[model samples]
Target: MTSLVRSIWGEPEERKLLFKIDFFVLSFVCLQYFSNYLDRANLTNAYVSGMKEALGMTGHDFNNVNSMFTVGYTIAQIPQNLLLQVIPARILFPVNTLIWGCLTMVTAAATHVRHLYVIRFFQGMAEASTFVGAHYIMGSWYKDSELGTRGAIFSSSAQIATIFSGVLQGFIQVPLAVFIVSWLQRPSTKNLDQLHGIAGFRWLFIICGLITVPIAIYGFIFFPDTPETTTAKYFTEEVGLAFILFCVP
Candidate 1:
């Protein structure tokens, strides 16, 4: 009975302790995604905010902008994936994200139909890299058993981004804007509905752009090239388990 109890209570050799990198990496991925979805859905928010009325856009223009983004997205897809293979993802992903962030902010600057087309085109190219690149990174590093969890996490990120945007615009955007207006001596936002002669939709783009800074910095500073290259704080066993988890899927 004593021997059996000892065996049952013993630690498994394969078990690992928790680590900070685990937390950092997971949070960075999710944060990047939250900003990404917020930026992407800003157009939809703009539509709801009477941006179409302000800009005199018909639903046709909105549809055209979305379609144009899709076309650019399709054309850029394969090359970007290939590029992710050759270029260091650490450098490439952040740069691409920054471009998309700026383009998203510039969406507010659209004065004519052509402005939307141009911004959306570049924004599509910038946006295409991260999703495919992140998936590829997970695939390269994570094992079969770990793949499902990674994929699930990735999917949940997308869902969360969309949900954040929807909930903010649906329930919180106006109230939040009003609060900002009243709270500050020099508000970070002048008026979400109108800023610098641009419609409020553009301001949302700018907000999304700014919001990504911490995450982009995190990726640049912490995302290692490989498991062996990591400088992030983790126990030896934790690092080993991370690779094991990566490969499991």
Candidate 2:
């Protein structure tokens, strides 16, 4: 990054474009990370909102949900990584991300207690690629020392999204309820049932889905698959900085 920064800010105009591309690409990368977290965390938000009562979820059931998610997540890591090699990450990752986002929304539709288990298992499968895959992409492009801050920033989006979910859940509850009324014409009445039933869950899922779709598009449109193959159209200088940062480690 230091190399790219000096090249862009101090070097001749001919070298500046790549550095600019690098900056925009990283910016897109970080923002997708933020949305990635938001989808991952909507479960916690759903729990507090009404998934518990609507589905009669016990502590054991919830624990099992997490447990199943963990198992599925762990099981898929190796295969997912292998799949990365077989697939074009720029295509595979974003398309899969959007699919995961859609799955996240469908989770709100779970009616029986067992439904949560099944959905979470699959969600785990979808999300399984994220950690290892992200690092794989990062390591492919970034040098060791330079990866620290970029990785930190990317990782930190999870924490940021978690904290923000609390506030978002609180504020969106009523508005989401109203949205449910309009979208599905569900329950045909106003009450906790209306606000906390399948319609309500659908609304939350739909919201999470909407937010994730654009990030997936950004990944497809803006983020580079690797330093060797960056395709940023407007900022060549930034791309060079990203290349230099990846090279440092």
TM-score of every prediction relative to native: 0.77, 0.75
Tens digit per residue, CA lDDT, model 2, 1-249: 465455545445434543543464456556666776777677777776777888889768878988888888888888887998887778777876787777777776778779878877887777778877887787765557668887888788788877766656654555444453465434554422344444444556667777788888877876667656656456544556655643466
Q: Quick one: best TM-score, which candidate?
A: 1
Q: For candidate 1, write residues 1-249 as lDDT tens digits.
A: 334333443335333322343354555555666666777777787777766776678758989988888887888888988987577776777777777777776676667776888888877877777677676666555557767875788668877877767665543245456554354323555345554454556556666667666667777876654454455454444555555443444
Worst 10 contiguous positions by lDDT, candidate 2: 189-198
Residue 192, candidate 1: Cα error in Å is 3.9
> Residue 13 of candidate 2: its Cα lDDT?
46
Prediction 2 TM-score vs. true: 0.75
User: lDDT score, residue 235, model 1?
Assistant: 49
RMSD of 2: 5.1
Q: After superposing candidate 1, which stretches have Cα over 4 Å from the reference?
A: 1-21, 170-173, 178-191, 195-198, 228-249
